[model samples]
Target: MSQMITIELNGQQQPLPPGSTVNDLLAIVGSDGKSVAVLVNDRIIRPESRALHQLQEGNRVELLIFAGGG
Candidate 1:
């Protein structure tokens, strides 16, 4: 079995598999992938690199969502 790691998600601590990537985090957060932005330890993550970004222990992650308004 893989070790589970804890990360802060939207201010709450969440447990994830050791090998989890940004893409996996997106899935956990129920992101539709259209109007969302991701940041890890204050670094902006491009959409194309989300899959390649590997999360580490005690990494600070922030997720932003853009909503359409008139």
Candidate 2:
């Protein structure tokens, strides 16, 4: 069984399974990151790297969702 770890996501503490990638995080939050920008621990994560971006414990993540209105 995978151990659940706590990480800071968007200023809130969230529990996720170990070895969860950025992609996995997005899925859990119900956002695909397609129209959103992510800042992980004060670092910008590119879309291509999301799948491989391993989230560590105590990491601070921020999701910037872009909304369009005309």
Candidate 3:
């Protein structure tokens, strides 16, 4: 089994396996992949960072959703 870490997502605690990418979490949470911003450890993660980013233990992740306006 792969290593795992616990993180907080949208105020909830969840366990994520090591080596998991941002895209993985989005899928796990059923994110639509649009109008959403991801912040890891108080830093905004760009699209390029998704594949390169790795979740660490005690890390805090915030997923913010933005609404479309006219």
Q: lDDT of all the models against the reference? A: 0.84, 0.90, 0.83
lDDT comparison, 1 vs 3, better candidate: 1
* Candidate order (lDDT): 2, 1, 3
lDDT of 3 by residue, 1-70 (tens): 9767888887889898887788788878888467579999889988777877887777789988867778
Ranking by TM-score: 2, 1, 3
Q: Write the per-residue lDDT of candidate 1 for residues 1-70, one digit (tens) a residue.
A: 9788888876778888887899999988788555688888888898989888888877788898866788
Residue-wise C-alpha lDDT for candidate 2, range 1-70, written one tens digit per residue: 9788899988899999999999999999899736779899999999999999999989999999857778
Q: List the residue pairs that clash in candidate 1.
A: none
TM-score-superior candidate, 1 or 2: 2
Candidate 2 has which clashing residue pairs, if any? none
**Residue 11 CA displacement from its true place in model 3, Å:** 1.6
TM-score each candidate.
0.85, 0.88, 0.82
Judged by lDDT, which candidate is best? 2
Candidate 2 segments exceeding 4 Å error: 68-70
lDDT of 1: 0.84
Q: Provide C-alpha RMSD values for all models, in order.
A: 1.8, 2.0, 2.2
